[model samples]
Target: MKNYRLERLSSQPIIQTADVQPFIEGYDVLGAFNPAACQFGDEILLLLRVAEAPKAEKGYIAIPIIEEQDGVPTLVVKKFKEPDGDYDPRVVTIDGKVYLTSISYLRIARSRDGVNFTIDAKPFLFPTRMDESYGVEDARITYLDGKYWITYTAVSEHGPGVGLAVTTDFVSVERVGMVLPPPNKDVALFPEKINGNYVLLHRPMVSDIGKPSVWLAESEDGIHWGNHRFLFGGRGLVDTKFEWEGGKIGAGPEPILTDEGWLVCYHGADPTHAYSLALALLDKNDPSIILDRSEAPLLTPELPWEREGFFPNVVFSNGWVRRPDGTIWVYYGAADSGVGLAKLIQE
Candidate 1:
């Protein structure tokens, strides 16, 4: 058991699948969670990752895909016969090709009091390019250069990669295309430039040589990223007593600049793929240096909603906002089905 605890703000999920409408016809929402949070004027905006799947038929499996024709994008469904391989609620493997049972896109939910949210009927961001043929999911919003820079995962036939979009007002968004190549995600940009260079925390999926862990990168311009450095490792390389993060770890929300240093909330998983959130502090001047890190999880799967759902035993976050009172409001996806809120209060 851990010593520190995060205060659960709501007993139930703040956002669920039932609260959202599918962007495409003949589709059902599977989950509405993993929101990127920020403040716009007097309202708190949550860029929600809404996953939807086509209704099932008797003998065919339907896969949702985005195809462009005549310079226009359209959502199409492709049906396939069950093939030889493993099948799950999330994905199906047909020979060497993998298809997601559900497709995801970003939507905006606005809340004035931070609890009650009114979601936009249409998706805030959806698949438009071939690179995002599979889906676009898990966004992190950072306000910099007088605009809100949104970094998210763009999945396609190639693989999952990092993509960028920007908005001055939430009404109109401009897609900046892919910032990082395939097999990289969980990116969070610093609120401002660090030492005259843009800094971001990203995770590159590794299997053969290195473990999946957090890395630091600097860009002269936000679009071109280079000079990658290993900041920290996951379970096999940390000082934590338990194997809570023995699987992999990734950067969460934008790092909070504190008097002591940069406070970051990152998510980790065990060998079982159970996800949890923890804290890490980095040098204010040089974020590549680790100041301190939590030995135990700050938030984990405990509540029933968090322990069971579309994907069980998960409490993943990509967004958080700091209040005037110094408490941080963390908005996370519970069990990959619903959105929940928690708080980190200064002791």
Candidate 2:
């Protein structure tokens, strides 16, 4: 079966980096990306990706990071200034000198109405282990039989890997070590177990050898995962030797079981790496089979705000919530600038 993209969503982007990160010294640029949402009582809760930049470098360059605090994530960064007027940062000491600079942290935000939000003054996740010295980014939220699982990208000099955390309330989070290693990301988990085991969708890429495609793994428990296997691969167009998936594709939000099948929202990019969101439906028992899939994109960069931002032409999400009316509130990162949302209806 073939599917297409959803270009027009009911909800549009309503937020961006309106100011700098409040915690970091001389930091002003701030916004949330990769939002995680859940229903608490009668209100909706969200975990946003708040990004910050430190005092401008001597050359005025900066890097994006999501710092860890206490045990959660928030936006807090370091300010760098060299005594010798040198612009060196401990994160990456170039020009043969090491210096301290501003760091980025991730914070927690709550919303009763789902549109308007209130953020905490401090960070939720601060700099913790050396492995996460850089920070966190792109979190996928999953609520299962009795728990909420968050899978995200943990970054540092060691490289970018996937991390997991489970929580009942949004406040306290139990940290799980890196699940997938460097050069790996885009993790989405099934809400419930399949045959008494957990299911995961992730992407593993290689610049030279293996193409970036969707991979699947199952675990008895959410923490430890094994049975690593490749689930799907891309195909090239007519007269091409490659697959059709263009660049690659990965799981979208947590797979939702419907009468149609196990629907998974996924991201796919072209050879140029122009990213967009797509959809795929798999069999309930045997998720390996592609029941119905999108031939095009579900969402893309079209609006002014979505087209122009920190990182131009990008829409990435790991979290979404379904209201009683069957309306889907999608929390996502736009242009890599800040977090935003859109409304979706499965017709």
Candidate 3:
């Protein structure tokens, strides 16, 4: 097998805390990353997961609480004393309850060349429902049947779940409510139905009891899912030696339907929390059957920008676009603080 060429687009964070400060509180810090990509008209669009949190203090940390008021969602700032909570920058845990240190919302960014992008100043999607009180995050966009279907991670006091929404022009969106229940995320829907049923890949995390892995489910309407089957579990007698994805694995961008099969680029991590990207192929007729998979990672944290920031040693993606010339542009978030682009060209 031939390796693809990977190119780095930028070293700095494309969208930063300063860019989002005008819309949110001045004390809020922006950590814009984890974008979902699609081709609209002549431009490449990205739905960015913008994470924001109040300025940190020595004795306490502030968390954003969501509440509904007169059919609108509002954020309430709450402070948790340092002694009561254990913080790891991304999330805070207290008294058996888990709270994200920041609230996330989806924003838009457009690029013509797939490298240079201009981000919209205002948010495209925000926390309006009680389920998304914590915020919407890590969106994966799939354009099918002439509409863009967005599956994202919805965070709340209850836990993380999968939320769906649809849009045609991106100017307006129709909410599709929650599809998968809490303790599950990393969802990516197939662009086309398989055998008259929709297929979806997701990761259902159950803390220490079960090792998180990619799963498959089928639905007739794309909302009500059933026939759940285990697709790829990273740990087993054969997979015991692959430590890179042994800790956890999840689906990334929408799978590319190719002549070989369904091409899926997935993210995996080791027990040390180091993230990497890998490739897999599934049978086109039956997505639940795996055809081939990369034993090692295609991409990892190799640069300074990818090895340092809010969440270090992480290179994660929710979106990618294939050009007409067979070039695949993979846009990913580095260290959970900045966005970067890498191009993969088949040799």
Candidate 4:
């Protein structure tokens, strides 16, 4: 049987708390969760995952988010228990010290060695008047047809959704608005158009929606997406108690068009939220159709550091890079703590 290896790429996190302070809060700093790395004009850019805690008052909960005015990326101090309160995660105090229960927002940074990074002066993509009232998280970037397409999570009091944004120079962002409806996240777009149409993989979570399974969706102009169908659902296994998806799974990075098929890296979590990375070979002509998938995990939380952190037992990804020679570089978040990488072998 062929086995997939999870080798350590970098010891230092690409986007760490030490570097991302003052611009954002540290109490709940966990950037680079779904970092999107790509080579542009001779340099590699990493889209980091940045989270912040709500500022605390005497007894009020100061929610931290990207203010929705001028889109300049600022913090707001709001009471926690508002009638239309946020619903991404909860931030409640236990005894005395404050903690970040749920901090959601989009953070960006650039890198040279794919390890050392410099955060933007301000947030690259923040909350707007759209579904981001709750917050933004997990961005997957793809460069296609002379433009960059960004697929991200739009969180609100209602639920989590997917949003799209386009850019050319990577400095000025043109928001295409929320593409996916509600209760959906972890979207990965095919690096290029499939059959003259945009192909994307997304997962919509519903307690009654037959578990958090992966789904397929297609777009025409890369903005509005629809025509949902099942790409692949979790299977019942002897070791996994014959259960489908534990919690969720979706495409990790932009799909790489390979000789065999499109190499898709995704994440699968059980009911415990312990995430592990996996692979699924997709048909190049029609990526929505799954060709083959791994029965076992390609990369799981086996290390001490990966087994413990803000959220223990987690190894999630949203981006990767594939060289011309078929060499692959995958970057992921460790226990929702920092960014890590591994190699992809398709021999």
Which candidate comes out best when scored by TM-score?
1
lDDT of 3 by residue, 249-301 (tens): 89999999888899888998988888988888899999988988876778889
What are the per-residue Cα lDDT tens digits for candidate 1 across 171-259? 99999999999999999999999999999999999878988889999999899999999998776455546588878899999998988
The digit string of per-residue lDDT tens for model 4 on 180-257 reads 888898888877877788888888887853766778777798777778888876664335742324566666887878
Worst lDDT 10-window in candidate 4: 80-89
Angstrom error of the Cα, residue 40, model 2: value is 2.6
lDDT per residue (tens digit) for residues 114-198 in model 2: 7777777776665565556676766777888676788877777666788887877767888877888887788899988888999
How close is every model to the real structure, measured as TM-score?
0.96, 0.82, 0.93, 0.85
Candidates arranged by lDDT, highest first: 1, 3, 4, 2
Query: Which residues of candidate 3, in runs, are more than 4 Å off?
Result: 1-22, 70-72, 84-86, 235-241
TM-score of 3: 0.93
lDDT against the true structure, per candidate, is 0.90, 0.68, 0.85, 0.71
The ten-residue window of minimal lDDT in model 3 covers 1-10
Q: Residue 270 error for model 2, in Å? A: 2.2
In model 2, where is the ten-residue run with the lowest total lDDT?
Answer: 1-10
Report the CA-based lDDT of candidate 4 relative to the real structure: 0.71
Q: Give the clashing residue pairs of candidate 3, or none.
A: none
Query: Residue 301 CA error for candidate 4 (Å)?
Result: 1.4
Candidate 4: pairs in clash: 31-49, 32-49
